[model samples]
Target: MRKWLPLIAVCAGSFLFLLDTTVVTVALPRIGADLSASVGQLQWVPDVYTLVLTVLMLAAGSLADRWGPRRTFLAGLVVFGLASLACGFSPDIGMLIAARGVQAIGGAALAVTGFALLVAHYDGRERGTAISVFFAVNGLGAAVGPLAGGVLTEYFGWSAIFFVNVPLVVLTAVFTVFALGRDTPARRGRFDLAGAAWFALGAASLVHGLTLGGEGRWTSPVTVGALVVSVVAFAAFGFVERRPEPLLDLRLFRDGGFTTLVACAAASTLTFAALVYVSLWLQTGRALGPVAAGLELAPLAVASFLTSTLAGRVLHRFPPRVLLGAGVLLGAAGCLLQLGLAVPAGLAVTGIGVGIAGPATGAAIVAAAPPGRAGMAAGILTTTRQFGQTLGVAVLGIAYQAGGLAPVYVVAAGCGGVTGLLALVPRKQARVTT
Candidate 1:
């Protein structure tokens, strides 16, 4: 058996990070009642966390590589735990949203560091095995989230969700420090204020556009202006990345592996995005409760956890393209199946297919990054994935409002199909990507 202690630590971090994202959905109503938040305020409660994490996540990766994963990981744990406590005791919606943003900042550090360290600690087959285990733990958190949230909300109140995170954070931090030891951390030395500012603003503008999209007028002056700003900021970011002593390494983009990595990363999140919509369909349109709604998503979680381990073990001999392609195809099939869901079985099957697809796609991306740049690659992918969620939320919400679920599902299927084709693109092995 693998010396599982280190991996357990990584998995623990993942569980805490993701647990907050999904489990809290069940408690939103309770939270709204307690905080007296408007619908928009309620939406921001989760969106703000996701937004902050996606925007700064790459910076966190840079910090991790410059310093050491161990240090970054531990810092994230402490901050996230404390933030969780703050969130639990939030006196108003604004405070709760602020605390969520801070929690996301800490989560960004842990996420980037965890993936990178696993890449360093495990190699070849073992590496994949470790990542699979890490994600599986996350799947467990998601599976239990609604039940946990419901129970906590029904009994202890919505604050219980935040309170629950406190102990997990402490336990994970203690175990991580013990497992990794007290090595001096690596430092990236200098902060890239220009790069961070430009990138963060770019992401903020883009998400702002999407958030405003729910109100209609995706092309209104505000939305269009935000999009224009995003374009300008990204253009500026490209310039900064090309400079000497750049914050992010652009050379990684030259490698074919990197292309595959980005595409696959996008695919992984897209699959999850579709899953999010399907669950929304079940809960809102069908009026299913949280527990039943979560069960509908369980098949995907199971397939992802199980296949991630299997993919990790077989990745070398099996070409990543084939695996990722097959997985994408499965996801596309599942996504298409999702459109036809009049029954829970249909949703679950689609989720299962997407679950199988995610690990293979992630494996391909992981294979693309060089060891030294692994944290950077993982950070970029995580940010991309998070941003994709916001985009998915916007796009599906718009499509649903404008054309209803059928059109939205059709659009999602088209996206999945397109991504599957990208997966088949004869891409090189995983390597460091900018």
Candidate 2:
């Protein structure tokens, strides 16, 4: 019973985290109507969470290492629960966005520590099963989220979507404290504050610039300054990482296989970002209601849940390159199909594509890491994924701002195509080949 408690607690928290990601898309139209949100503000509604989560994720492994997983996990639940309450009660878009930032802090912590706890609890073949279940539950949460959001938002209002988190989080916390016991002995690691600041600022600046430039002209003074800040900050971050005990080991990228796996995480998520655009189009362009839009978009989550479960089981039998390359191409095909207004079919295909790649990439990442650094590796993978999701939203938002939904879909397809090609390039030192 104790053995399974950790997995249960982690999955429950992760489910709530991912549920919010897709669920918000379904509520966007309602939020905009109620608050008179601008396009940029609406984008910020979701992207802000990804931004904070991505930035803080670099330090999540360090926090877990220093404090212990149980403590970190509990802290995340408290923060996330409180933030959800604030979000539900928000009277304006500004307040909701601010609350989302707080939510991201807790989310980043849970994401890193949850995977680390899972790895620590299970080993050998059982470990594989646990990891598979982890990815499967993630897919399932993402699958259920939109429908749940649709129902809640349609019947109870948008606030209901957020308010629902309060009880779920509270229950999860109780189960964790009682069943998971105490944290393990802590590992020592210096937190690289400088490196963390540089990277976060760099990412934020670049995202802000791109989002603004995409809204207007790239030559604007504000856009140009933001771009410059992003470049310098990222360059500084690269330099800082050269020091011993860096927040992230720069050498990890030197491994072609590991890098490819990270790319797979990014690419798969980039495709997932399309659903945001699709949801908006359904509500805004087609004039669909929240529940109607959610029902239409349900196939994406359903496909993801089905394909991810199967992919997790069969991952041991295929090469990462083949699985990821072919899978992402399938997603690219789905994106292309979306050009003709075949939204449900395209989304289902895209879901299948991401589902096939997600578990395989996650497993490969954990398997490829140097011994004793599984937690760090998980943090890096999740960070890369959130970064990709953020970039997708920014890029697609730009396209949408410039030319509307059609252009955004085209750009999304192009991104999927690039990731597909990159996946085929065989990684060096192919460790853990199936």
Candidate 3:
């Protein structure tokens, strides 16, 4: 029992952090009403968290390398707990958005270091088992988020969604301190402040611009300016990463396997983001309450949990390309099934697809990394996924507004098909376990 305490601690943190990614979806209506928020402000509630998480992930990974994963993860818990408190107490939309951004900063730390800690502690068959459990929990957290939010918000009020994290954070922190092994000696290196800044600017601007576009402001000067800034900042990030010890090693992209894994990571979330809009449609369009809407979406969660658990058990036996390609193709098919209000059927299919790809994607990305670069690899994987969520919500939100659910499903399916094809590309070196 004691031997698995660390896994418990890490999974607890992973569950809490990932839960926040979509937990707020069901509660958005309640939050908007209470805070007197506009539709745009409501969208920012979720987008802000992912945007910040996506931007800070690389820096957090590098920080973990410098400070050690244990310390970094502990720090993340503290920050996340504090941010959750602030979010619960927030009196206005702006305060809530700011607090959520802070929460993502903590989430980024937890995400990267948690993967590093798992890699540090487990190996061989044990490693495969640990990662499978980790990814299963990841799927569970994401899958159940909307349901949890609905129950909490329907009965306890919307603030309970954030407040619920307080006790979990406390318990997880204490368990981690006692059960997790002490960190290895920290790596010595100069932190890449320039690279971090450039990446942050680029990502933030890109998300902001997309958000504006979603709001039917594509021709607005602010939107155009934000897009332009994103382009220049990304260019600068590419240039800065050419340094010997950059924030993100540019050389990682050279590996076809690694690149494929990252693309799958992004696609998984991109397709999953449809759930947010689906939840919204249930409540606002179908006139269901929070709990009812959440219940309607339950099949996705159930399918994801079962599929991820099964995938974890066999994760070590198959090639990543086969698993990833098949998983994403299924997700695309699921999206297509949702074309005409077949919500439950489409979502369940999508859930299975996401579940199948989830563990394989995580294991492959981390496995493909060179020694001592697990943190970087994990960070890149998470960053891309979070960015995909951010982009999906923004883009899908636009699609929803323009032509309702039809366009949203079409766009999601199209993207998933392309991503699935990319994952099918031959990459002989991408093994999940040794």
Candidate 4:
């Protein structure tokens, strides 16, 4: 039991970070009302965290290489704790959004280092067990986030959601300090400041434009300028990454399997984005309280957690293509089902589909990487998934504002179907299984 202290510390931090990604969903309405926030601001509360985390992820990985994962992870805990405090004390929506963005910086560090720390500390069977435990903890975080948020918000107010992280961070940090070994920087490579800048600018601009467009500002000069800047910034990012030691090695896309898996990663998060609006709809549209709305959504989280656990046991039995394709297609079907009045049923199906595909996709991407590029591949996969979640929220928020829940479901379903089929496409890669 004592030997697993390091794993517990790492999982604790990782779980907190992942939980924040979705825990805010059930509390959005409360936040909006309390902060007097507009829909766009509410969207940013979650989007800013994910967006910052997405853009900073690769850079964080590099930082971990330079500073050592233990130190980086500990620093992240401190930063995350501080930011959570600020979030709890935020007087207005703008302050909350800014704090969430700051929180993501810490989250990026935690996320990039968690696996590395595990790999360094454990080996063989113990390593495998540690990883499985880590994955399970992460899944539990996602599954319980909404329900936790709901309960906290219902009894203690929405600010409690942010305040809750303070103790957890302190506990995790204490365990990490004692359990983890001393730091040793692995690489002295120059950080890709230019590539990081370009990617961040591009991704932020893209999301900002989509948010503006969602708010019926598509014709506005700011919206047009943001969209244009996004294009130019991404182009610059591509150019910048062509350097010898780019932040993200753009050359990885040359692998057809990597590209496909990355796309699937992005697609997997569409439903995640959709759930934000679903929670809102349940509260504001259907007049359910936060707890009730979260309860209604409980099936999605529960089903996902259970399915992932079950899938992990038998994941090696199936081919990557089948698991990836079929799981997402099932999620797409679940999304379509939501177009009707069957919200819980659709959400449960979506959860199960995502759960089925989650482990298989991660394992396949790591396995397919070319030798030393595995870390980069994992970083890219994670960044792309977070970016997908950000994009989905922005785009689906637009659909929700323009038409309603129906349009959001349709768009999400359409994306899932397309990406699902893309995952099914044959590629010349070695067979891999979880």
Candidate 5:
């Protein structure tokens, strides 16, 4: 009974975080029209949540390190629930966007520490299984969000997107409060305020630049300044992470498998973000509408969730390189198919192939990481993934802002193919798994 209880709360929070991110994609235009938002304000709907969460993730990781994961996780649940309620009741887009920033703080607190909580209690193969299950459940929430958001927005209203989070947040909070017992570590440290500060500001500046590109001319000073700051700040972050008491452990990347894991993580995120646009193209470009577009792209998420879980189970037996190579091949094939996806059949086939790539990537990353470093490694993976998605979204925006879906597919296919080739590069000692 005790063993099963933690899984329930963690999975619940995972679902809520992912669900909100994916679901909001469908509500963007409606949100703009209702709130009378400019393109920048509209972009903030997604940008604020991602920006704030990305910034605070390292701090959350440090908190888990200092006090313990259980106390932090429960605290996150309470705050996240309140933020959801704030988002639902927001009177305008500005208020909703601000609420999203708070929601992200809570999400970062949960995500950076959630898997660590499980790993602390479990060991070896069981830990692998738990990671697999957590990814699977979270993947489901992400996969389902767009379709659900479309239906709710169409029949209910745009605000229904936030409202939908209410029940899920409540349930997660209740579970965390009742089921999770306390746990703490003797180890402790001061918060790496400087490192976290750099991450938040740098990421926000970068994303703001990218998001602004969708609304205005690329030559705008606002865009250029944001981009410049982003670049400089990120470089500083890299330097800071290498400092003696870095906010994030820079040394973790030195492990042989770590770089490969980061690549896989970034690629997976790029794929998910691609789906968001490709689905939009199916509806907006081809005039199909939200549900039709969602149905068309559903195969990818479904396949990804299933494959990631299954791959987790077998990862311990296979060499990590084999999985990475296969994933690269499949991802390349998926990209090629996407390049050909001018028709619905082409879209469906490409989407399903991409879906299968998700778990293969997840399996390789989790297998490559050391046990105690899982939380830190996971943070890096997610950060890289988010960065990749940010780039993918920006690239798609630049190519087809007038809303041509075919060109977007062509770009995604090209980017994905290049990343896949990089993944296939030979390693010095490639047999990473025993």
Candidate 6:
């Protein structure tokens, strides 16, 4: 039991961090009604959080390695707690959105460091077990976030959803401190602040352009300018990362296994974007309430949780590439299933695929990282996931508007099928040494 305490603390904190990613969806209507926010503002509430979280993920991992995971994790808890408080009390949409951005900053820190800490503490079979549990809990949080948000919003108002994080974060912090103890300093390293800035700017600009374009601003100068900025900033980022002591080590991408796993991460999370459309189908197309919609989505979470455990146990016997290919194919089947009469089953099936794929891919990426770079590898994996979600929201969102929800599912199915086939391509064994 004592030996398991650190995993508990790490997973708990990670759960809180990831939960906020989707929890806000069910409360958007309430927030708009109370705050009188515009459609764009409502979208920003979630998009900004995602944007900040993705932008800072690599930087957060660097900080964790430089300062030690324990300190970085604790600081993130404090920032997230304080930001949640601000979010809960904000009187207007702008304030709430701003607070959410702050929350994402802390969330990125906790997310990268929390997983890195787990990798640090466990190895071999034990490491696989810990990662599977982490993925399961994280998936569970994301799956139930909407339901939890709806229940809290229904009973205690939307503010309650944000406030709920406060206590949970506080408890996690306490447990984390007790279990992880003080941070011991590692060798100090140079932080490429300029490269980080360029990356953040590039990512934000791209997301902003895509979002605006999706929202009927395609012809707007603001949208065009954002696109241009994204291109230029990304070019600059590429140049900057080539320098020594760059914020993100570019050499990490040379490993084919890590690169494939990153692609797998993006592919798996693309389905996550489909979840929003599913909720919309339930609420708008089917006329279900938020709570009911969320409840209907529960099967996805339950299936994922069970399958994650199954994956953990079976991973030892199978090479990661095989497990990864199977998981992706399962997800493809799930997406294709949604096109027919088996909608709920499709969602659950996709959850099962995600359960197997995510942990397997993550473990491969972590194993492929160079010595002392596990945090960076974890950051890259999550960054790809966030990138996929952002793309899904922007691109699929447009498809939903133009062709309705059916076409959106078709696109998702196609993406899953292609990625699954790609995962089957033979690759050298993943590098697992420090």
lDDT of all predictions: 0.70, 0.81, 0.87, 0.83, 0.67, 0.83
Candidate 5 per-residue lDDT, tens place, 1-434, comes to 68868877887887787777677777777777788887567656766776676777767766676767778887777788789889878888889999998987788778867766766666677676776677777667777777887788878887788777777777777778777777765245566777888887788888788777766557899999999998999888888887654666665566645566566556655555665666556555677666666666666556656665676677677665556555645554565666665344543444343444444454455555444444554565556656666666666666666556556666666665566566666654322221
Residue 108 lDDT (model 5): 79
The alpha-carbon lDDT assigned to residue 104 of candidate 3 equals: 92
What is the TM-score (0 to 1) of candidate 2? Answer: 0.95
Model 2 steric clash pairs = none
Q: Model 6, range 1-434, lDDT digits (tens) per residue?
A: 78778999999998898888888877777788899998678878878887888899988887787888899999999999999999999999999999999999899998888888888888888888999999998888787788887788878999988898998998998898789857654437688799889999999999999988878889999999999999999999989988865666666667675567677788787677777777767777888777887887787788887888777787778878777877877887888888785878988998999899988987887867767776777778778888777777777777777787787888887787777777778887555333
Ranking by TM-score: 3, 6, 2, 4, 1, 5
The CA lDDT at 186 in model 1 is: 41
* Model 1 per-residue lDDT tens digits across residues 31-133: 7788898755676776777788788888887777777788889999988999999999999999999999999988888878887777767776677777767
Model 4, runs deviating above 4 Å: 1-4, 119-132, 370-375, 430-434
- Which of 2 and 6 is the better model by TM-score? 6
Q: How does candidate 4 fare on TM-score?
A: 0.93
Per-residue lDDT tens digits of candidate 4, residues 349-415? 9888878777667667555644434335446756877899999999999899889899999999998
Task: Give the poorly placed runs of model 2, Cα more than 4 Å off.
Answer: 430-434
lDDT (tens digit, per residue) of candidate 2 on 27-108: 9888988999987788898889888888888788767766787888889999999999999999999999999999989888
Q: Over the full model, what C-alpha lDDT does candidate 6 score relative to the true structure?
A: 0.83
Query: What TM-score number comes out for model 3?
Result: 0.97
Which residue pairs collide in model 6, if any? none
Error of 5 at 355 (Å): 5.9
**Candidate 2: RMSD to truth:** 2.4
lDDT of 3 by residue, 276-345 (tens): 8888888988899989888887888888878887786788788888889888888888889888668789
Report clash pairs, candidate 4: none
**Alpha-carbon RMSD to native, per candidate:** 2.7, 2.4, 2.0, 2.7, 3.3, 1.8
Candidate 3: lDDT of 39? 91
Candidate 6 at 277: error in angstroms? Answer: 2.5
